[model samples]
Target chain A: MLVVNTEFVPGFEVTKVLGLVQGNTIRAKHVGRDIAAGLKNLVGGELKGYTELLTEARRQAIERMISQAEQLGADAVVNVRFTTSAVTAGAAELYAYGTAVTLAGGA
Target chain B: MDGDAATFNFLILLVPIVLIVLGAGVGGLTARTHLRSLERREAELTSIEVNNLKFVRDPGSAADTRMVLGQVVIATDYFKSLATALRNLVGGEMRAAEGLMNRARREALVRMLEDARSMNADEVWNVRFGFSNISQMRGKQGAMQVEVFAWGTAVRRGASA
Candidate 1:
């Protein structure tokens, strides 16, 4: 499925609006990784553990979003956006939302 | 007793001077190096056109659309930490920390542009950034940090629309 953050797709035209579809996930690393991150803080650099955690969460959220779009028979999802919240000290919530639409000519 | 007191006073005077010199030296060097690298990389990406405009004027045949993302996380240096400590007392703006955030945003954008350029995309639009911190300030879970993430769509414009 075609997915973009723009209001409209360049190649395809939107035929039918399927309203808003959303997906979200919350995730956290284990205590071992948190301990490693605490050590990494001393040197000052990228916290790889947290990065991976967020990336994975985003991926899962997007997958679920896409599945929802598919159920709505959307050919593309436009104006996609991602948001994140620190639900707690360790866990984070990532949400993906977009407008699902059917292409005019059908891709 | 006199000699020991004098020695103690001398050591007390030397410590902060040493810290200031260290902070300035390291902070200056890091800023210089980062600026040089940012300039070099920016020059290399001069050809890749990036904009936040939603529409492109010369959109070619609708080629393809794909998501591109760039992210960077920066931690405070000794100088910034020291400055922050001072700022906390006076409660004014923290220039040191602000500079790091600026650098992170620019660096993240550059990386995102590079990614789009590598994908053979002529332009990217509707760019957005996400800023967050990890497990910082969770009572020893981690040190403080700032993360900048840039995301956008790389579109291959149609040759003739």
Candidate 2:
């Protein structure tokens, strides 16, 4: 599927609007990663483990959104957006949402 | 026993002072180095244009288009955290925390641009940023860190255009 974060995809027109599709996931940092992040904080630098954790969560959220779009027979997902919230001290929720639409040309 | 107690008291006093000094020296160096690198990379990647506009005018026959993402998590050193803590008492701006956030944002943006460059895209559109504070514990302000995520649609122009 063609996914773009813009309202309209270039070279294609939307023929059918399938409304909004969304996916979300909440993940908590494990003890090992948390400990690593704590030490890294002392010297103040990028937390690679946390970055990977978020990347994985975001990818899963987007994948879930895409699957939902596929269920709606969408040719593309447009105007996609992501948001994050700290559900708890060590856990975060990642949400991906977008409009699913059928384009004039198939992906 | 008295001497041991006295020595213990002195050690307690010395630890914080040592930590603050180490934080200042190392953390300051890290931030400076990172800023320099950001400047150099930004100059190198000036060829690719990026914007937040939802739509592109005359996209020049787009060959390919897709979403790109960049993410980063950054934390403040002990010195900044202490500085912020003290600033909280005075109710003033936390310049140290501000610098940390700025660096994280720029790093995320630069990474997004690099992702676009890898795709051989000429322009990025509809850029958006997402952020969240992670690592704080319940009922306590633990290590302070911020996560910045930058995303956009990368467009590569067709040969015809």
Candidate 3:
């Protein structure tokens, strides 16, 4: 249930490394938001709409990764990393990956 | 009727040019303001401790570590984006785009520092960063949006050293 981006958790010994666990999600652009972003691009401040869209995508990807780690009976997930790609013109794909491991002590 | 049509055609041609000029002016002002704010924030964060070391070399320090993450996404305006489009064509360095990216990374780093400060963390270690593109569309020409993310482990000293 715990997640850290470091390879080793402080004060906890990794007894078993389950394997790599990952999750990914692809989201397409919304027509309304796309129009809003286009207008924002003209004057260009932060496009709050697009920012929120990517934030939501990242959160969902992390949630899915956590579920997979839980299924593996892992005490913690470590060395987590996120990557993103523009697979198509109007779609974005986000991937979250990490190593699942069990600590010597129960969480 | 001829005069009316003539004015209509002239108006149609004038509007897009006007919009681009106005967009440049507004976007310039916004960028200036953001730069001032970022400079002020960076000054404020000067007191916070930061490190990119692999681990705490001084052992027996007994520090509690927790992961901290910060992310910021920024969009380009009409003027700089035009410059970027040109850079793409000629295959040369894009200084304008570089400035925009620098701003995004600084914003993300400041947010991470704020998170560490909230937890009374004296120093951060194992810092990392990521950059990604998002909010793409088919019809839009020369539109670029990027997100910068920062991550580190914040450590609070437990007085065990």
Q: Rank by TM-score, descending?
A: 2, 3, 1
What does fnat come to for each candidate? 0.32, 0.68, 0.47
Q: Write the residue-wise lDDT of candidate 2 on A5-107 in tens digits.
A: 9999888879999999999999988889888877777778888988998899999999999999999999999999998877877678899999999988522
Q: Rate the local accuracy (lDDT) of all candidates.
A: 0.74, 0.88, 0.79
DockQ of 2: 0.64
Cα lDDT tens digits, model 2, B9-121, are 99999998988888788889999999999999999889989999999657448888989999999988888888888888999788998999999999999999999999899
**Which docking class does model 2 fall in?**
medium
Q: What residue pairs are clashing in model 1?
A: B60-B157, B60-B158, B60-B159, B61-B158, B61-B159, B62-B158
**DockQ of candidate 3 (2 decimals):** 0.48
Candidate 2: regions farther than 4 A off? B137-139
- How far is A12's C-alpha from truth in model 3 (Å)? 2.5
lDDT per residue, candidate 1, B1-161, as tens digits? 99999999999999867766665676566666776787898898777667777764443365777777777766655555667778888998888777778877887888888888887887788899998765352333223567778888887765555
lDDT of 1: 0.74
Who is ahead in lDDT, 1 or 3? 3
Clashing pairs in 2: none
Clashing pairs in 3: none
Name the top DockQ candidate: 2
Q: Per-residue CA lDDT of candidate 3, range B69-134, in tens?
A: 777878888777877888898898898788878888888888888888888777777788889776
- For model 3, the superposed segments whose C-alpha errors exceed 4 Å read A105-107, B56-63, B87-91, B135-139
lDDT of 3: 0.79
